[model samples]
Target: MPAPPPPSAAVPRRRWQSRLSPTLVRDRCYTRSFHSAGLRPAAVPLPDGAVVHLWLPPTAATGANPLHPVLLLHGFGATATWQWAPFLRPLLAAGLAPYVPDLIFFGASASPAADRSPAYQAACIAAAMTALPSAPQRYAVVGVSYGGFVAYHLAHAFPEAVERLVLIAAGVCLEEADLAAGLFAVEDIAEAASLLLPQRPEDLRRLVGLTFCRPPRFMPSCFIRDYIRVMCTENVKEKTELLYVLINGRKLSDLPKISQQTLIIWGEQDRVFPLELGLRLKRHLGDTSELIVVKDAGHAINREKPAELCRLIKNYIVDPSVKYRDDRKGSWKNAIKRFVGSSLRKVDSSRPLL
Candidate 1:
């Protein structure tokens, strides 16, 4: 039998974890943001001993011609709240029933099982979403950074259920060769993991610099220390394991087999994965995928350019006829349809769903 889900308590913050800290304040704001967007928080238990905490619109997906279901998955560092808060209102207004889930070991979700692979994370989320009171027969997914890895697996695992797939700055096709080629600044996987899951304030600073195009010139050490203590401290072991599992023991050929109408969005100036990987992924995904490069942006493009991102997403999924300009000077560049041409046959893989 699976272990029970973890508890999420709302307790007062200690001096070291002050309420005034930006992280806490932003979290509070995200809560209000969700409420204002017609969404409320909920949780469901998965068979694999993990409880998934997600925020869904009050009007759940139901009935014939129901509102389209959209699942937004967040990456590392911050939980779903911080990463996805900007998208809630925009997507909801566009007639999408958005569901933002904190992957296992993030936010209110937790798992006692030793598994930390993206595949397991995808399975757990699939189970929780399907167990919803009014689950949709099909849904769309948008994942950024690490969440892109989970999204890729989720779409691959449930191809029939996922109607559309979107990956933003997700290096799903990265290989061991990319690391050796010095495509990333880190010396090795361990060094990359350390930088991403920083323990010290200085490490956190380095991470921020890499994540943002224009990181704050001066962040108070107190806030850095507090943020690190609150956000980057928990699930250290499991997160590190996740990093290894995602990067190592995998080849380029292992790229997820997905057939959903796909959209690949990337920051042209992305340092972590770089723009080259995005182009490579476009080639790998074949004609069904479209690539959009957000110019002058970095790895954290979702936060840096939320409105433009939302516009692109809205047009792609909601209203293709309603063309929106890439206000950030970004351009929509569809794939050149190199692999086997646009006549490629769809490939399907079978996996159990909740």
Candidate 2:
């Protein structure tokens, strides 16, 4: 791919945080990562009139291979760029075009409609892909946390358009009873909502503590407050509704009837969704499904263990022979062993045995 445009021309300036702020520097790095991967920003308007801003890989990134579209959906809290930055280059290198969409009410995406259900969110994403010029006949979706709910609904709503499904730390099968039973670290749904949709520094810190297995001990209150102001303050009502509809509106029985090949990835120490939910989802998805858990990680495995997540996703999407055992008690060592072994078998028939 050609060299990225100069910083001034390529990335728009944001004046909210000083350039020296850790957060702003990290944001710049994320944007640079996207540009390095040949992902340029674009926007699409959904049928419901909501607009989605995305970073899409350039034609050159896909090389000479026939286009294989893949959708990367971010969960609640942050934009698609923040969550999927690490995976873009790898997917592009693996000859897959990545479409990273910011869900409605997040980032540059917005829906004026009052509907906040997962199905509605899913529909908006499906419409975006369909609107793409020469849309892929079938695409794969990888969703993290709340995005997984959207992904599940997307597969169910448009199975004909989806070839594979990957759920990361998404608790699609959790029932209201699980919340009542203290399955989550929070006391109740209200507390959970408050933490997830935190408007205060303390609440944001709580969220970080739950999200990361090893969260930073001393994030400046000013940074947390600023992050909440810039990222978490938008569409607060609709976001809350999205959470409510997801946790209260669905049950295990209502899980989407997705027939596509599925992969369930979880963070072993995830406090938000817990590993049990991932195992349950794998079993519910039946024989065609596989579960891989990242050890020493938490709910934000995409951020905590990005390389492993990217490799697993790229392998599953590009390699037809990749096989993942259904292990509910998976660890990092086992996952590495399995992934390396699988990758080896694809190239070297006489490779050393694991």
Candidate 3:
């Protein structure tokens, strides 16, 4: 809206070797729509004595043309204000209606109270939602990054409430030791991995690699820095509350039980949560769910490829059949395209890749 507050820092460029392909160029169109239309924030009270920072649809919302309130959930360290802005315009344009809320510990939401836990946070989100007054009865959700993990649990944990599910860079659980080393630590991913998930390394390493189709050299330092800030900003007084939320937020074993319609999208060239993971998630979710790998998306598709993502999102919610088929066909097309592009570029640059 208002000229973006000057970027916290210059955006880091991908080494020529780490560039995205032409097909991944879905929505490079840029506009100032969202800056002028940001919604006012509201407070959502929870049963556990916590308060969440939420932005509600205009109360003057018209019933004859009321938009469905889309609840957007944030990632592990992100706030509502920081995470959902990129997708807001498309959501608004789609006319499905959307609401962005920061969980208790992350955004403007108050820090955790005595009973805070991941389940407690989830319950708080559920409770805050019940207080909203929007209609046209479409219960659609879109979660970004780690928020995707919560969306998964939310859909499964409260199946009757949500009608559609949108997972962006959705996260899954690992034994800690299984996580990828590149995902954490300000300087050294391996060292950070060892410290954060000492007991479960392999799973974490694989998970981190899955985020990207290919990892970049000299990784985006600025993103990593901002990421560190988000993680560190947690209400320190509620350490246990934040920790609990991180450790137990997702449970993939329960994915098959969710009856809500689901849609999954990832940047095909994403090094954060690779396309293969999206493929596996597709099979596990079955024919009812849809998955698309945003051609050149990294972990932040809304920021990098906002236009295409926005269009896909709008179609996914308003035109269900179209999105479902697009997703089914899209993932396959994008992956093959990414593979070919990588091979060509690798050959041209004389870069070594797997």
Winning model by TM-score: 1
Q: Write the per-residue lDDT of candidate 2 for residues 41-87, one digit (tens) a residue.
A: 77888766788777766862344334667889998877887887877
Q: Which candidate comes out best when scored by lDDT?
A: 1
**Winner on lDDT (2 vs 3):** 2
List where candidate 1 sits over 4 angstroms from the true fold: 1-17, 61-65, 320-354
Better of 1 and 3 by TM-score: 1
lDDT of 2 at 170: 89
TM-score of 1: 0.86
Model 2 ranges with Cα > 4 A deviation: 1-22, 60-66, 325-354
On the 0 to 100 scale, the lDDT of residue 141 in model 1 is: 92
Q: Report RMSD (Å) for each prediction in the order shown.
A: 8.9, 10.8, 10.9
User: lDDT of candidate 3 vs native?
Assistant: 0.56
Sorted by lDDT (best first), the order is 1, 2, 3
Please write out the lDDT profile of model 3 over residues 1-354, one tens digit for every residue.
Answer: 557444443333332312342211211111123235545556866665678777665431443444555778876545675566667666766675666777766656774366555555667777777765543344688887667766776787777777788888764532232232222222233433332332333433333443434444444544443334334434654644444444432345534446777888777665545455566577677776777776655665666767777777788778766645553346644565555533222221122111
